[model samples]
Target: MVFEYILKKNGLDPSTDLTIDQSISFGLTAAAFTSSDADYTIEFEPFATTLELEGNGSVVASLGTESGYVPYTAYSARKSYIKQHPEVIQSFTNAIQRGLDYVNSHSSEEIAKTISPQFKETPLDKLTQIVERYKAQDTWKEDTVFEESSFELLERILEEAGQLKETVPYKELVTTEFSTKAVK
Candidate 1:
């Protein structure tokens, strides 16, 4: 979506001017681009960084860094589920907050070493580079508050992609009650 938006802004129609092929995995997409199976692919970090490390491809653009796009990772549940499981959600949020705090306080090399076991296929050095890059980019949030600008960007992207029919107010879509409590 970010690439499509960028292409549109640059006066290129992705639907008409480009043959956009979707791959099931980022690794495969990177491989396709490296092998000339696809002209370009939009990839997010860890995987993208790994590809560059392996000399498969180079990053042409970094939407988050270069384009002012604030891409984020989120955890969500249905409103009904949230209401029924507020305590569970609070516990999970608190745990995540603690984890984030740890990551913020630690070195990238330490973090990479700690998490490397989970990614058995990825080299520790490569993972360290990926973590270091993300750290430098300030990709991890220290707090759980959703920035209004980030939400607006997300809404705009969804609308442009025709995935959203009506605008959902931020309050309706996001609940800061748990995050606030967790932070405290």
Candidate 2:
């Protein structure tokens, strides 16, 4: 949906202008692109960086940058769960905000080193490069609070992709209670 939204925003019709192969699973996009199966693929780091390092493809554009704020990463809980575990949710939100604060305060190199254990196959230099790219794009929000405008942007993107039948009011779908309190 994000890819299609970026395409349409740029004045191209995704349905008619070009072929977007949705058959490739998210995990294999980099492999498919590297294998020359597709001329271009939208990928998240460090796949994009890996492809560029391998000389398979170039990072042409960023969907995140192009699509604007869409609240792509967020936490969700069932209403019942939230009602029962407000304290748990608050703790989780605080932890998330602390992570955000760490990333915002630290350099890309520091972040890459800290997270390198999760991606043992990916070298520190490459991971740093990926983090650098993301930092340059302001990929992380200042806080975990999912803004109303960002939620609306997400809804608009969903609606444009024909996935959403109607827009949900921000208040009905999102609560800033935990995230707002976390930042404070």
Candidate 3:
């Protein structure tokens, strides 16, 4: 969705200007790009860095950078659940803020070393490089607050791609109460 939004933002119609091979499974996109004649591929970390490290492809652009701040990963709960479990929500948000604080406070190499166990197959140096790239791009948000403008932008992206049937008001979909408290 973001990639398509970026394509349209750059004055190209995705349907006519390019072929996006959705047939490739998400996990296999890197491999498919490496093996196939596709000119470009959208990929997430580790895989994207790995591809460049292996000389299979170049890290040409960041869709995250191109699309601006979109909250791609967020903690969500049913309204009923949230109403019933406000404490739980606050605690979870606080934990996420603590994580954000840690990342913001630490050096890329330190953060990479700390997270290396999660990516056992990746070498420490490579992991550090990936972390450096993310840090350079300002990938981590300083706090857990979900900005209304970002929510509106997300809906715009979805609308452009014909993925959003009805736009949900930011107030209806998000609450800054917990994140606000957490950040404080």
Q: Each candidate: how many clashes?
A: 0, 0, 0
lDDT by residue for model 1 (1-184), tens: 7777777878989899988886456557666677776756787666788678778777776677654545457788999999899899999999988888878999999999999999898889888988888788777788776767778888887788888897888887888888888788
List per-prediction Cα lDDT, in the order shown: 0.79, 0.90, 0.93
Better of 2 and 3 by lDDT: 3
Candidate 2 Cα misplacement greater than 4 A, ranges: none
Top-scoring candidate (TM-score) = 3
lDDT of 1: 0.79
Worst 10 residues of 2 by lDDT: 32-41
Between which residue pairs do clashes occur in model 2? none
Top candidate on lDDT is 3
lDDT of 3 by residue, 1-184 (tens): 9999998899999999888889988999999998899999999989999999999999999998999999899788999999999999999999999999999999999999999999999999999999999998989999999999899999999898888999998999899999999999
Model 3 bad stretches (over 4 Å): none
- Cα error, residue 178 of model 1, in Å, equals 1.2
